[model samples]
Target: MNKTGKIYVVGIGPGSKEHMTFEAKTAIEKSDIIVGYKTYIDLIKDMLEDKEVASSGMKKEIERCTEALEYAKQGKTVSLVSSGDSGVYGMAGIMFEVAFKDESHVEVEVIPGVTAANAAAASLGAPIMHDYVTISLSDLLTDWSLIEKRLHCAGKGDFVVCLYNPKSKGRQQQIQIAREILLKYKNEDTVVGIVRNAKRAGESIVITTLGDMLKYEIDMFTTVIVGNSNTYSVKEKMITPRGYEL
Candidate 1:
């Protein structure tokens, strides 16, 4: 093992080549090794020509981070890649966690990128324009009780709610639970928008209502925007006023 090793936890933005920031590109181009999940690896495949790449798929996040640590320990400048912002439910946190546990590994530098929340908000006009609370409906890392509590709190506070990981193959009821929680403070006609595969090919924006969300097919790739009591749709675009109007 050499001694000049450093780890860069790079955010590749969402999924588009154009979304890849200049700083991210520079880091990848300069890295001695690139490590990430398979999807993230595929997303930046072209940028990794002639670069040593180690990609993991369907493995526990700790396992992936451990591999990245091993690569970095070998004195290789490594880039740990994550789709969307690396810190937004992404790999940056886990990588740092591993580093902290092992003093032999140096601290990691996290490079921020545009998260899905930002991209989804852009695609859906301004659904998250004002005060909004972003939450993930996935119960993997968080408990359902906490998610429900946040959903109700966000609804009562009239904050636009941005939901991530709304649905997946085995987890299907969390979104419905979230919908029920929001319905207490939101009207059935309250506008809700769904942005799937944001900034990627096959991107789509669906604007509907609190009641209509159940009728739509949602997946892990989707980002759901549930409007507050004051949210509305104009010209078929969802817009939540930030209260900046005079």
Candidate 2:
């Protein structure tokens, strides 16, 4: 039989087995080897206990992809895992980049999963119901100035904004900067919802206002959802009506 020299770049979704898709599970079940970030692999340690696993740390993305590709080239099925949707800030793009540059002929599959924005929105009770835009405050690969420009546009358009990587140890001021820019276009009372570790253990959900958003603690695990000009907070929910009139 011809070797199934293929690599599956799968999204496991929010680090919970329940949130993981059947397609993702099946792909990993079929794969002979699995490679991903150490945190991601640890999330499913029990499920992948018997599989040949190669785990990488925070910044070694290229090395992880290269290892997966090399394993596939040896006629082994490899599942390269990512936390959220493989296409969104995940390993799928990296795998494709490596594959194209090296002209590797291995078959590649990309599976989608829930991203932090969507997961946090759901936990916050539909803050993303209206027109919304997602922006990551992390400037590792993107420039802070460009991110600020996008924030400005979202503010002018009154788009509900979902922010990823709001604050980390090294970069702590971007969230405050984002709030300042949005305040120019949005009200100080605009509703804001903060979700940390969505759908995972020790998850935390906090509802705040644009005026006092900075008073709360934020980190890489947190996702901040800012409502549009029309968004409202009632009881325990942050909701943006989809312009449907009763």
Candidate 3:
């Protein structure tokens, strides 16, 4: 315990031990306290035996980061965990912002992990091999109008689009609207990949087309990939070729 304890923002990937990176494991092992969402904390609970753990449900992100920083200020090594890459809609950025705003002097390190888009893509097929954009269909923090503009732009550019938080129990129409917007600019038969619970238990992947995407059930766990104009399916594998000739 010293005045200069360090904080590690670690990405744990999908809620599975297999997908958790070695760097994340090491950082957690070296930390004196663990802080993350309740679900993500449970993912590595076995490895955290006898360690101090602080977990909370959704909307507690700022509280969680603040607690971790306080623990670090007390000369404790802290691990702030996030699902997927910490920089991608995860805790790293938030932690840094809070640290800078508070003018804390603790060192910070970010460890990257496999993202939902990559994990889901591996399960379904390669739909983002070319120019692509990653967007979250949820309108919680972002305005719906802005999201719609981006969706329409992605469609116009024929960019392979990776969608996060496609749908949930309360908000089911965002993805449906996204599907409709893309349909206007892309072919009705454009390929779309749906993956639920990527890299975790009961994982499911479906390769369908733009016209039929709305028929499938989706939730926060699902990651949807809308293929570009050149994307196609070969033997159930959605491949977006990078212009390589055989």
Q: Candidates' lDDT values, in order?
A: 0.87, 0.92, 0.91
TM-score for each prediction?
0.95, 0.97, 0.97
Error of 3 at 224 (Å): 0.3
Tens digits of lDDT, candidate 1, 53-99: 98888656898788878877777888999888999889888888888
lDDT of 2 at 20: 88
Where does the lowest 10-residue lDDT sum fall in candidate 3?
121-130
lDDT tens digits by residue: candidate 2, 47-94: 987899999899999999999988988899999999988898899999
Model 2 off-target regions past 4 Å?
1-4
Better of 1 and 3 by TM-score: 3
For candidate 3, write residues 157-212 as lDDT tens digits: 89999999999888978998999999999998999999998898899988999999
lDDT of 2 at 95: 97
lDDT of 2 at 26: 96
Task: Write down the TM-score for model 2.
Answer: 0.97
Looking at model 3, residue 47 earns an lDDT score of 88
Model 1's alpha-carbon lDDT is 0.87
Query: How close to the true structure is residue 137 of candidate 1, measured as C-alpha lDDT?
Result: 89
Model 2: lDDT to the true structure: 0.92
